[model samples]
Target: MRQTRLRPPRLKAGDGVTVVSPSWRGGEVFPQRAARGAADLTARTGLRVSISSVKPGLCPESRAGRAEEFNRAVQDPATRAILWMIGGLTASELLPLIDYEAFGARPKVLCGYSDATVLHHALYARTGATTFYGPALLSQFAENGGTPELTMDSFAELTMRGWTGRFPTASEVIEEFVDWADDSRPRRAVPALPRKALRPGLAQGPLLAGCVPSALQLLGTPWLPDYRGHVLAFEFTDDNGYGPGQAARDLWQLRHAGLLDGVEGLVLGRPRGWSDAQREQLERIVLDVCHGTAFPIVTEFEFGHTDPVLTLPTGVPVELDNTTLTLLEPSVR
Candidate 1:
């Protein structure tokens, strides 16, 4: 049964936001970069920002600590939103510790991507809270020079103010990473390739967007959402262990689980750190797995680990026809 989707109140200037690390402690590992991100976030949105009280550790106890920070942020009336410090592998570890009841009672804007996809699906399943699948602190705002205008503008339009209509794509994307140790160096970007139409058709349905591997990890768990009648959007991350092989297996896993049975459309983000050949292989793998599916399939739409991404609201209605994507409803009140 699908829960009643809740659209959190839109943010305004001076809205309070709490940054939490439910996964990797990017803030703890790179304090200078974190500081830069925090400053940039405030400057960009005029939202007063504060960091949650959590430390870096991979111990069992650390997960509990991270969950507590997330809970407090959700429960606090002063916090209009919760921002992720960064995405990592351990977000699933905090799933058991999250206070879904508190989150349901006090639905606040939640923004993140990559590993945070698990949390998004969990929230959508348990609370029906619409969360923004967008940039993380260190990853976007803390970019060496500054946050990309396209990324910040989308974040503001979708999460802070209400927005509806066609989504914009970034003409250039930051694919090259500048080491955190060299915080002064700006990231180099390459021109974005045109989006491809893997399967041609048209459809509009509620958007279900997330990281590929993180979302697959939720399969068979209560956190995995009901994808029937959804326009599923996913992106491959730059995680060292993931590649075209894993991508095939993951999509097949979804197909086997029947999660793709009623999907209305499919949108894929350009994979981070992927060569042209690898991307072509990925497209072939997708078509093979979703073979005979009548829905439209588009690839290389911007989102996920890449810089200058759109802030997509999970659970909102979206139209996808070939390479074009449009938001059909407001993501926030």
Candidate 2:
């Protein structure tokens, strides 16, 4: 069965973006930082920003309320894009409560990463609407030192217009961080090593991913998009240190579930904090799981939980030839 993917209308400067907290209510503790993200988004994208009335603490207090806010954003004709402020463990809980009918009716650009993967796959599976597995308001937009310049520039370049060709490569990476503990803390760049390509091959197909842990959480549930024929991507974000041992086990679980079956390819983002040995182990795990398959696999090609991140439209078709990955079309109308 060939599923038709939905493209959102292209967003431009002066469009409206609603910011909401789908998972953790970190915004309550980082209100000022959250506001900074809102302001930065406006200043940077020229899009008017409207944060949902549900403040962080009170908002997360009720999962249904968060879903309602997301519903409101989806229904509001003014909101051309919806950006999650940050991610947490429980976005999956909102899956049952989301206003899919309201959202599917007028789908537009909806973007986030990490825990937001729940929504990305669910939205794609249930509505066929493409969602972005990219930066979040507080995580990337409001990143200290003004979020990474490359990240902001790339986001603007990709989303505001149709993105094709090679995504701009990061000369530097954001591998470390200082907490957004205070509104007054100065934004600073995290340390990075230049991005590297770990494997080489060519493959093409629709995109499917979730941080390994999130993938495990959503897989076999109603949320995960069909894995058949997808260019599957996996990265892990410290749910339990996710060391090489843990990561390999997670991949094992995914493979065991048959979720990795018949994928067109597999791409991996940088595993944060992994040593050279751990990264080596991850490669072995990929080989172990995909031993007999022709699926091309590559690692550390950016596009998850990492800074200088690439904005990827979940469910969109992509081409990967070695480290050179390309989008097949503009993600929007």
Per-prediction TM-score? 0.96, 0.92
For model 1, the stretches where C-alpha displacement exceeds 4 angstroms are: 1-4, 55-61
- What are the per-residue Cα lDDT tens digits for candidate 1 across 209-319? 998889988988888789898899988878887889989988898889898898899999888888888888998999899997899999988888787888989899889
Q: Estimate the TM-score for candidate 2.
A: 0.92
lDDT per residue for candidate 2 within 1-333, as digits (tens), equals 224457788889889999888888777778888888889888878988877766445545588778877888988899999998888898888889887877678888998889898888888888888778888888778776576777777677667877777766676666665656753555434455544444557888877766878868886677777889888777888555568787778888988898778788888887766777887777787788777777777787677787777787777788988767788877777
lDDT of 1 at 240: 87
lDDT value for model 2: 0.77
